[model samples]
Target: MARQVISPGWKVVIGSGIGISFGAAPIFTSGFALLTSAMAHEYGWNQTEVAQAATIVLSATMIAYLFCAWPLDRLGSRRFAATSIALFAISLVVLSQVGPSLSQFYLAAALFGFVGAGTNVVSYAKAISRWFDRKRGLALGLAASAQAGGSFIVPLAAHGIITRYGWSAALLSFAAFEIVVCLPLVAWLVKDSPPADASVPDSGSRPQIAEPEVAEADIGAAEIVRSATFWKLALCFAAIGMSFYAIAPNTMYILTRRGDVTAADVAWIQAIGAIAALFGRILVGLLLDRLHARVVGILTVLLMATSMLINGTATGVATMAAASILMGFAIGGEADLMPYLAGRYFGTRSVSKVFSWLLFAFCIGAAAGPVAFVRLSTLSDSVVTPLLLLSALQIVPVALFLSLGRYRTAPEPAFNLAAAPS
Candidate 1:
């Protein structure tokens, strides 16, 4: 692909998008599950409650993201995200002050979940998709990888901080970190569209100007809502949320079941997994640009299935490490692909709103994953088996993606920057 026209404004969008991805990642992912032993030990909470809270957090996130979707496009990504970021920072601090009460913990988790829901990869993906098409997947992937990078940094940092400092101190530090990291960047650069995005270039020397495109008929969203592509993508993405979040929230839980896996080994596995995700995200981003989105998606899903199978059949320390890394590959790829595919099919006009709705579907899957896994595991007294079954569930998304190949995005003429803007 030719070098992407990354003007100064576009660069800022990518940076802020990365911040959004990173700051938003830690709240709902395996962070709690990884730190479960430390949290439970400190707060004197039971296993069931702790596990249940993970589900609640995902549930809260699902609902919040749904609520934020269309409003975000209308309210503006920057404004919507700003409020959510503030909520996340404050929630973390308040959560640290939480006592042993289940209700309090649940409330904290809900706030955290809600904040995370509003500020996520979808927003970042939409912002980038508006600016670049040729390299859209790569840009989206790199921004998406910020979340994976956060998954790496936050857990390790939390583990060390909680081990050294108390949970309250560590949490205060976490909140402070989010405020410092997300606020200034988002406030500065998170615009809804590029200056040229909504305008057309004039033929010769006519000066160009930014204008929000208006379509005739003002097509009611309900009409778009009823399309076959919509439901297929929604269901597929939701399935993705299920399989991915299930593993994310349960990695440490599954590891803890065994007595011999050392902290050093777990740390190494997690670090390796995080590192792998960065590459995986970048690879999918690159691939999505050059290759067929759904074909690449199918391959990535298969790779993820293999990873899940490895996770299911785990015996000792080595297999666990490999599984974590393999699973990371899937998470990273899908993280990149979802938004890229959205752009490939839907275009930038309503990308944020579309992705927001898709993410709501994703949230439903995400919420069900960890909580259901925990519940079923408790009921059946089996962890690995229940999780392994989720692999089969992922196949449905692969089929849905295949069906999606027929849905093509409009060929919006690329903004020829050298030409006069109109």
Candidate 2:
């Protein structure tokens, strides 16, 4: 038997995974939880105040996603990724050096968000969309699993370093990893697209099934903005970002408040959640390829709602652990769905810009969710109230997603180029 060959597309997936594994999202979502308590204690700041850093990061990130869309298409992924990763490393270093002032920390968070935008899903998804049409969902799933991998590892590593050395040391180590490891790997393996002649499967390779070639239509920004489907997607994702993401940063706090779970237990629970997320992404991708995307999306949202309800009512370690697993799985599914839906509905011609607008909506929800959660907790003096409310809000996305109807099918040059927004 002959050896099976890997495609350049798969190589781009590998590079995308590695870059994302060490990118800003994981560090913010996982590592920052560990940092929040540590920084709050060290500086005599409230946990809520420290947690505002996430809001700052998301606010800046939305702006960056909007501005970077044109540049990402112009410069291409390789050059754009390299520059952003380098700047992201510097921002991490700056974060590691923050003094007593909360303002200083917030500024660093802003820089972290703005410069690190390229390292997020926008660029990687854009690149992966160019390469694999038949397997785009699975390709994106494999790439996104890296975020779960990072989430699983970052908390453990950061917890260890914070316990032994300090929070700053852990951040500095992350910066070094981005510089020494992520930078070189991304620069070497990532490309904008496959060779022009290599769209078909190689000779002697297993025959791949063909899917609807929506990217052929190549819808532009002007067409996308005018479409009703676009707004539905934006609303769906924004609600997803708000209702689901509210749980991530506050996981440790929620568990600790129970007074029975230890710090190590919390870490292990998060790790288990991340593992579930890893599988969830891959499984959802397979399902998306085989089934209707809206059906899969509705199921994912139900899973998220269930997780929130479990978390709100959890009284024991086992229940909390179960809640975490469900939460992670839903988060993973949403991550995969966002790009998959973007490519499917709008096509790839202006996917990055279109995705940027959707992501901007997501960032808006993300920035507001935690603050809303915290405020509700303070007002009602109960975490359960806010969590249950968020769980109910999942209905909004489920309804919106169902209304997306069918994917667009149009001939090539579907929209006039001259009318596209600058």
TM-score of each: 0.88, 0.92
Residue 377 alpha-carbon offset, candidate 2, angstroms: 0.6
Give the candidate number with the greatest TM-score. 2
The C-alpha stretches of model 2 lying farther than 4 A from their native spots are 1-4, 199-218, 409-422
lDDT of 1 by residue, 342-419 (tens): 555665665666777787888788878777777777887877677678877777978887877553554233465545
Off by more than 4 A, model 1: 1-6, 196-219, 410-422
lDDT at residue 380 of model 1 (Cα atoms): 75
By lDDT, the best candidate is 2
lDDT against the true structure, per candidate, is 0.70, 0.81
Per candidate, the number of residue pairs that clash is: 1, 0
Tens-digit lDDT string for candidate 2 (86-200)? 9999999999999999999899989998998888878788888777665677888988888899889988999999899998999899999999999999999998876545542
